[model samples]
Target: MKIQTKINGHLREDEVEPRLLLVHYLRDVAGLTGTHIGCETSLCGACTVLLNGEAVKSCTLFAVQADGGEITTIEALGNHEKLHPLQEGFWEEHGLQCGFCTPGMILAAYQLLCRNPHPSREEIRKGLEGNLCRCTGYQHIVKAIEYAAQKIGSPDA
Candidate 1:
């Protein structure tokens, strides 16, 4: 199957197997290793990405299912020179230990902030419930998201 999609603001067309998972397409064809594949069953949110402005588990969908859609992987969030607020928050708050789940956690928090810029801590917890992180005990992750919310609400962000 030939699927066309906009990834990280770039339009790309490629031939892929109909059964090819979106996570594989992002990592292999697009060469975006930031979107990791963990627990392909979707129990883990390591493969989360923004699909048409919504956070989705890439491992849960086939590449063909996202044809004509726009996707945002971790690479789109920011770069080393200038990090996204979420990235900065994660760094300052120590939201990650192993760092395996950082990308997905940040993306999920991005979506939550987009929907509710002033999410309460409880809301933040609910927002990130789908993503599992073996490190950090989630307290720091919540603080990171809160920090990002503040940054995103500020004029400089």
Candidate 2:
């Protein structure tokens, strides 16, 4: 199958198997390794990405399912020189230990802040329930999200 989609602000068309998982397409085909494949069962949020502005588990969807859609992987967020607030938050708050789940967690939190720029700690917890992190005990992750919310909502940001 030939699928065309916009990824990380670039339009790309590629031939892929109909059964190819989106996570595989991103990592193998598109060469975007930031979107990790933790639990292919979708139990782990390590495969999360923004599909058409909404966060979805890439492991749960086929590449063809994202045809004609806009996808944002963790690489699109920011670079080393300029980091997105979420990325900065993660770094500042030490939100990740192993760092395997950082990308998905940041993307999930990105969608959360987009929907509710100012999410309460509880709401942040609820918002990120879909993602699970074995390291950091989630306290630092919550603090990271809060840091991002404050930075994003601030005029200086």
Candidate 3:
């Protein structure tokens, strides 16, 4: 199947198998490996990405289903030269240890902050319940989200 979708602000049109998972399409076909594939059953949020401004687990959807949609992977966020607030927060707060779950966690927090820029710690915890991290014990992750919220909610930010 031929699917056309906008990814990271670029238009992409490619041929993919109807059964191809969106995560595989992003990593293998599109060469965007930032969207990780962990538990493909959606138990892990390793493949989370924004589809049309809402976060969705890429592992749960087919590439063809994302046809004509807009997808934002972790790469779309600010890079090393100018890190996104979430990225900076993760680093500043040591939110990640192994770093395998950082991308999805950050993206999930991104959606949460978008919906509620000033999320309480409990709210952050509730917001990120879908994503699980084996490292960092989640305390630092919560702090990272709080840092991002403060930065994003600030007048200077």
Candidate 4:
């Protein structure tokens, strides 16, 4: 099947088999490898990406299922020259250790903040339930999301 989707602000069309996972399509065919493949069962959220502005595990869905959707990978988030606020917050707050889960974590946090600009700490935790970070125990990761929320919105303004 031929699937057309907007990925990382770019329009792309690729032919893929019915069994082709979105994660593999993104990493191999599309040449975007930031989204990792950990537990392919969708429990890990390591392959998390925004499909139509919602977090979805790429490995859990076939590329054909993503046809005509807007997909955003970690690569679309930002870069070294101008990192997204979530990325900066993660770095400043030490939100990651091994870095394997950073992309998914950041994307998950970004999706949460987009929907809830001023999420409480507990809410942040709930929003990130799909993602598993095996390194830091998520204290700092939660804080990083909190920081991004506060920065994105503040009553002090």
Candidate 5:
């Protein structure tokens, strides 16, 4: 089937199979590989992406289901020259180790900050319960989110 969606600010139309997971479609067809694939069972948020401004596991969704929806991956956040506040916070706070879960973590944090603006550490933890990061043990990740929230004028300060 032909699915049309806006991805990373670009309007794209493609023919994808009903079984084609959104992750593969984004990586292969959309050329956005920042969204990694860790556990396809949805246990890991490695393939997290924003579906209509909310974080969702890409592997848990089919490309066809995303038709006409707005999708935002890590690539949508920022680029080499300019980094989003979340990306900058991750870098400044050393939030990533192996970098496997960084993309999803940032996206999830981005969504949380967008909605709440100011979130407590516990709220941040709860918001990111679906995203698992094995490298940093989550302290730096939480700090990174907190830093971003502060920088962006979120209430978490």
Candidate 6:
């Protein structure tokens, strides 16, 4: 199958097997390794990425399904020079321990903050219910989202 999709603001056209998972396409073909593969099942959001501006688990969808769509992996979120607000929030708030789930957590939080720029702690918790982190126990993760929300809601941000 020939899949053509815009990933991380770049247009990608590649030959892939029908069974190729979107996660593999991003990691193997697209050379974006930021999206991690934890369980390969949808239960773990470690493989999460934004598909057409909404976060979706890359491991659950086939690459062919993403053809002609736009995907945003963690690589597109920020670079070394300037970090995304969420990335900075994670760093400032110590939101991660192992760092395996940070990308997915940030992406999920990205969608949350996009919809609700001033989300309360409860709302933030609810928004990130789909993504799990074994290291931080979610306290720091919530703080990280809150930090990003504050930064985004601020005029200076």
Which is the leading candidate under lDDT? 2
Q: What lDDT score goes with residue 142 in model 3? A: 98
RMSD of each: 0.7, 0.5, 0.6, 1.7, 2.2, 0.7
Global local distance difference test of model 6: 0.92
TM-score of each: 0.98, 0.99, 0.99, 0.95, 0.95, 0.98
lDDT of each: 0.95, 0.96, 0.94, 0.91, 0.92, 0.92
> Model 3, 126: alpha-carbon shift in Å?
0.6
Q: Which wins on TM-score, candidate 1 or candidate 2?
A: 2
Instruction: Tell how far residue 143 is off in model 5, in angstroms.
Output: 0.6
Which portions of model 6 show Cα errors greater than 4 Å?
none
Q: What digit string (tens of lDDT, one per residue) describes model 1 on residues 70-91? A: 9999999999999999999999
Residues 113-154 of candidate 2 have per-residue lDDT tens digits of 999999999999999999999989999999999999999989
Q: Candidate 1: TM-score?
A: 0.98
lDDT of 3 by residue, 1-157 (tens): 8899999999989999899999999999999999999888998898999999998999999999999999999999998799999999999999999999999999999999999989999999999988989978999999999998899888988
Of the two candidates 1 and 5, the one with more favorable TM-score, higher being better, is 1
Worst 10 residues of 3 by lDDT: 148-157
Question: In model 2, how many backbone clashes occur?
Answer: 0
The lDDT of model 5 is 0.92
lDDT of 6 by residue, 31-86 (tens): 89999999887987999999999989999999999999999989989889999999
Query: How much does candidate 3 score in TM-score?
Result: 0.99
Candidate 6 RMSD to the correct structure? 0.7
Candidate 4 per-residue lDDT, tens place, 37-107, comes to: 99999898889999999999999999999999999999988789987789888988999999999999999
lDDT of 1 at 148: 91
